[model samples]
Target: MTVTLKNGVLDPQGKAIEGALGSLGFSGVGHVRQGKVFDLELEGSDKVKTEADLKAMCEKLLANTVIENYTIALD
Candidate 1:
């Protein structure tokens, strides 16, 4: 699962990173937003059920649903 703040949300960390990049002379890098990515090894074979469970996990604990959004991918 990956979690990130929704568009228009204030990202103080992202802003700080952008400033640091500018100070280091990395030009033209615009709007840096930071997020989380998780790699999970699942024991289930059912794709539908696994996705449902992952969504529940994101909603309940992994993400703050009010200001963040999450996406899940299976490999």
Candidate 2:
């Protein structure tokens, strides 16, 4: 699963990275957004059930639904 701040959300860390990049001579960096990626290995074979369970986990703990969005992928 990948989690990232929604549009218009304040991202201090992202801003800081942008500034650092500019200082390092990287120009034209309009905006920098940072997010988290979670890689999980599941032992289930039911794709539907696994997706539902992953969504539940994100809603309950993995992500702050109020300010962040998450996308899940099964490999």
Candidate number with greatest TM-score = 1
State candidate 2's TM-score. Answer: 0.85
lDDT of 1 by residue, 1-75 (tens): 999999899999999999999999999999988999988889969999999999999999999989999999988
Residue-level lDDT tens digits of model 2 in 1-75: 999998899999999999999999999999988999988888879999999999999999999999999999898
Candidate 1 residue spans exceeding 4 A from truth = none
Model 1: weakest 10-residue lDDT segment is 37-46
TM-score of 1: 0.89
TM-score for each candidate, following the candidate numbering: 0.89, 0.85
Clashing pairs in 1: none
